[model samples]
Target: MRASASWAIRAVIAVTTVSVVAACGSGNDDGTSASPADGQKLSVVATTPEVADFVRNVGGDGVQVTQLIKPNVDPHEYEPTPADIQAIGTASVVVKNGVGMEKWLDQTIDAAGFDGTVVDTSQGVTLRKGDPDDEEMAEGDPHIWHNPLNAKIMAENIEKAFVAADSGRADTYRKNYRDYAAKLDALDAENTKKFDALPADQRKLVTNHDAFGYYIDRYRLEFVGSVIPSMDTSAELSASQLTDLVAKIKATGTKAIFSESSLPPKSAEAIAQQAGVKVVGGEDALYGDSLGTEGTPQGTYIGAEEHNTDTIVKALGG
Candidate 1:
C-alpha cells in the first residue's frame, strides 16, 4: 500500500510538470508568447519602413518593431508574406500610413487573425486629393509624411497609440515623441530657408512618380510632372502619356528628372533623354516610396528627407 501511494504521488507530479510545460508552450502558432512577459518590450508591426521609423522613435526602447515592408521596396505594390502575417498575428499593435497606402492591409490583417490595436498615422493630417482620372489615387494622395508638419501629426498619433498599448511606458513614449518632433521642426525650418533662397522658377521638380505632392506643396515648389503620372508606382505609363510628359518637361524648362530609389530609373532616364534634361539616377535618386538601407544615414526619415532636399536643391540649381 505504501509503494502504491508513492507511485500515485510520482504520477501526479509528472502530470503536473507536463501540464506546466504544455501551458508555457501553448502560445501563438507563430512562436510568440500569448502575452508579453512582464518587463518585455511591446511587440509592434509597422506596415512600411517610414512607419517603422516613426514607431521606433516614439516607442523608443519600449517596443520591438517588425517592419513588414523592407527598405527601398515600393509599398504600393508590396505583397505581404506568411512571415509578415505571422508577425502581425503576434504583435500588440500595428501602425500604418493610412490614406489608402496599404491596400493589402485589411486583408492581410484578416488573414493574420489579428485583434490588436491599429494606429493610422495619417489621422488628423490634411489630405491632398489625387488626380480624379487615376483610379488608384482618386481617393487621395497617401504620402502625407513628405511634409514635416504632417509628419508631426503622424508622430503624435504614434505616441498616443504606443501609450494606449503600453501605458506603463507612457512617459517614455511622450518624451521620445517630443524630442523627435523638435528634430523634424528643425529639419523643416532649415529646408524652408534653403528652398526659399532659391528662385521660384528654379524650384520646379520632375520626379519618377507623383509621390512628392506634399513635399512640393510644403515648400511651395512647382511640380512639372512625373514619369509614372500617378501617386502609385504600380501604374504604367502609355506612349501618349510619355510623349506628353516629355513635352511638358521641355515647356516647363525643368532642369532634372529625379528618379526614386524604390522605382526603376529606366523610364525616368528615357524621358529625360527625350526631353534633353539631366536625370538624377543611381545614388542621387530620391527616397520617395521608401527609406534607405538600415544603419545608413538615409535609412531614417529625417536623413532621407535631407538627402531629397539636398539632391533636389542641387539638381534644380538652388
Candidate 2:
C-alpha cells in the first residue's frame, strides 16, 4: 500500500509526459534514446512492480524502469486509462505477466499500436491450471513469478529482452541476470528449508482467492480451497460459495484463513470467524498481482517471497 499512492502520483507525471511526447518518440518510457552499447540508461516498462524490481536488479543503474501496476492493487481486473495508454505507447520495452492475467493490457497496447519490444515472463514456464482443464493456462501459467525458479526464468528473459532493446548493455544485463539468479536460488533453498519443517497436513491453506496456486504447488502444500473460486480477486463470493468454503475449512481443520492486503479481508475474516479459527497475522500480504510499498520487505520480488515464506511457515507450520 506504500508505493501504490506514490506510484499513482508518479504515473500521473509519467502519463502527462507521455501525452506531451507520445508522438515525438523521445526514447520510449525511460526518456533515454541512446543505444545499450552507448552506455545510456535504457528505458524500460514492466506491468508490475515485481517485474520492475527484477529489471532494476538486473538492469542495475544502466536501465531506467517504469512499472505499470502499483502495490496492493489487483492486477487481474485493473483497467488502463488514457494516460496509461500514452505510457504504453511511449514505452520502448514492455514486460508483462502475459498469461491472460492482465486482460486489459493486450487490448490496450494493441489498440494503441505501441510498437516496442514486448516480453511475456510467462514464456517457457509450464503453467499450472486453476481448473486443470481451464483453457486459461493451457500453455503455461502467467503467474511465473510465484516460484523462485520461475522467477529466475523471468530474470533470464528480462536479460534477453534488455539486450535486444539495448544491445550495448548486453554484458551488463547478462551479468545482472546471473547475479540475481544466484540470489533467487539461495532464497529458494532457504524457503525450501522453512517449508520443509511443516507437517504435510498442516500445510493446507484456505484463502480469499486462488492467488497462491504456484506457491502451494512449489512448496508441496495443499490448497484446500478459496473464499472466491476464481483467480480474479474482483469476483465476489456468494452465500452458497461461502458456506461451501467454510464447510471445507471445517472438514479439513484448516489452520488459517488467508487474505491478501489488496483484496478485502472481510470475507476471509468472516469465514475464519465462522470456522472458529484464529486469523493468521503477519503473513506479508501476498503480492498476488502487484508489489508492495517501496523499501518495505514486499517492495521487491525476493523481499515479497521472503515475507510470504516466513508468514506461511508460521501460519501453517505452527
Please tell me which predicted candidate would have the highest TM-score against the true structure: 1
Candidate 2 per-residue lDDT over residues 1-318, each given as its tens digit: 124533554454445543444453534465444354365677677787778888899889887787777888777656666656666666677788777776666656654446677888778777776544445444445666889998988888888888877887779889989999999999999988988888887988876778778888888989888877877654567889888888888899888877776776777778889988866543455556666788887788888888878877887777
C-alpha local distance difference test of each model: 0.84, 0.74
lDDT by residue (59-123, candidate 1, tens digit) is 88899999999998988877666566667766878899998888777766665656667889999
lDDT of 1: 0.84
Taking all chains together, each candidate's TM-score versus the true structure is: 0.88, 0.86
Check candidate 2 and list the clashing pairs. 36-168, 37-168, 127-140, 127-141
Candidate 2: residue 41 Cα off by (Å): 1.5
C-alpha positional error of residue 313 in candidate 2 after TM-score superposition, expressed in Å: 1.1
Looking at model 1, the pairs that clash are none
Segments of candidate 1 deviating more than 4 angstroms? 1-37
Measured by C-alpha RMSD in angstroms, how accurate is candidate 1?
12.3
